[model samples]
Target: MRLNIKITFFFLFITKVCLAQDWMQTPIPGIGNIEFPSDPEIFDQNGVLIYKLENDDAFYLVSIAQTDPSYNAEIEANLEEYYEGQLEGVEEASGGTVTFKQDIGIDGVSAIDARISGVANPELPSLLFKRFVYVNSFNVSAEFRPKKTDELEFTALKDQFFNSLQLDVSALGSSIVVDEVNGEKDAFKKGYEIGYVIGRIAFWVFLVIIAILVFYFIIRLLRPKKKKEPKATASKPVTKQKIECTNCGKSNSTEAKYCSQCGYTLPRD
Candidate 1:
């Protein structure tokens, strides 16, 4: 039952991806329109269409991926619809896999355009890659690189995709040096601009307040309570209290045994 539920969710996830996303032309008018190629699930492979827009020697390649909601479990039921009624290829049961088949499209005629494609070993939440291969417009021997990162590295996927890259092909075209690559994402800068700094400050202040409250509670819970000091009973001062008896006109000392002037017994304490 649990396995059925998991599969059901996966199908729902695929359905969502198929239903929500529609191919639309992006910018630059109708230089190109992408068609959803037959979504085929190859056995251990993912694919996507890459469209390159080149103007004045500046090229921007955008990869369009078509696949079931591998990331979502809601629309797994519609996975077949995304595949156009095709089943996914058999894969090792140890790890889950989703496949995508892609067609690269470059609009218009390029007198000279160099291109490359390749897969990459993933690091983390980064998109999985295959490799990168370079080819000249002339279809002649161009270049191929398997390395992920190096100075003057040709094909590498770092962070998000970047568009502003300078193509430094010498006049002779014997060597190629790609420089002036722009548009590397400023994740922190963007986050900070959107009040990340303020959020961090608020978080720290909240933590400090929590710490102080915790310490106060601990000390309060641990410290011994006083016995109220027993309220030091206020001592009454001894007041001189002399008395005279009317019967004998006798003057008596306060708390005296008898009056000295008369042989009369006085009230004594």
Candidate 2:
């Protein structure tokens, strides 16, 4: 069961690589109309179309797909579980280490906010965030990354991408597509924004720890240790010796005037 769930999420993740652009309102014909920051790289996979917009510093991608009506019965049976499965699927697909998710709404359409980090892809930036919107007949999903280094600027851009999403069901009756989006940018919830910030901070902190370890090891290898010198031992002092008197052949101390055995006077040296 767990293996099946992971496969499902991996499929969803690789299939969905589709985000924001200009004020230009372009119609998607049978699908609907969408506003883009600029022209995106469009791909047609069978019936589903994926759009990707990116530059040196940021990326935005989105895709919409038709969902089976039969699944709707299951969704109704357990809506929370259904959403949780989707969230877990994405998390597994990205090979993410940490994930933060919340229930969100897009102009009444129910959606999930999925902010993830530590994807297997090291090339992927630390601040990768996305949203998935599920409609009765279709699924609309989008990813947003910012070019600006400033946290505030990145947050602003992220807000622009989510708020600009407009789902048009009228184009194909049950199908979903971008409608039109502009004006008073809706801000991302404070908690969700903080989650993104924390992910980035965590990534940098990990790098710093690695750097400190490397530096410490390098210093240990290069620096030399001092060898201790052996200490010198003290010698004992010499004591006075007794002298023999030539006149009486009596042994006496060098400082004594006479020997106790013969009472002879000791000569002064």
The stretch of ten residues in a row with the least summed lDDT in candidate 1 is: 176-185
Estimate TM-scores for all models: 0.30, 0.51
List, residue by residue over 170-268, the lDDT tens digit for candidate 1.
Answer: 221322111111111133235434664575576567556655655566576668987766567888998887877545877777766767777677764
Sliding window of 10 residues with minimal summed lDDT for model 2: 179-188
lDDT of 2 at 262: 76
Give the TM-score comparing model 1 with the true structure, all chains together. 0.30
- Give the poorly placed runs of model 1, Cα more than 4 Å off: 1-80, 84-194, 235-250, 254-269
lDDT for model 1: 0.33
RMSD of candidates 1 onward, in order: 19.1, 17.6
Q: lDDT of each structure?
A: 0.33, 0.63
Among these predicted structures, which one has the highest lDDT?
A: 2
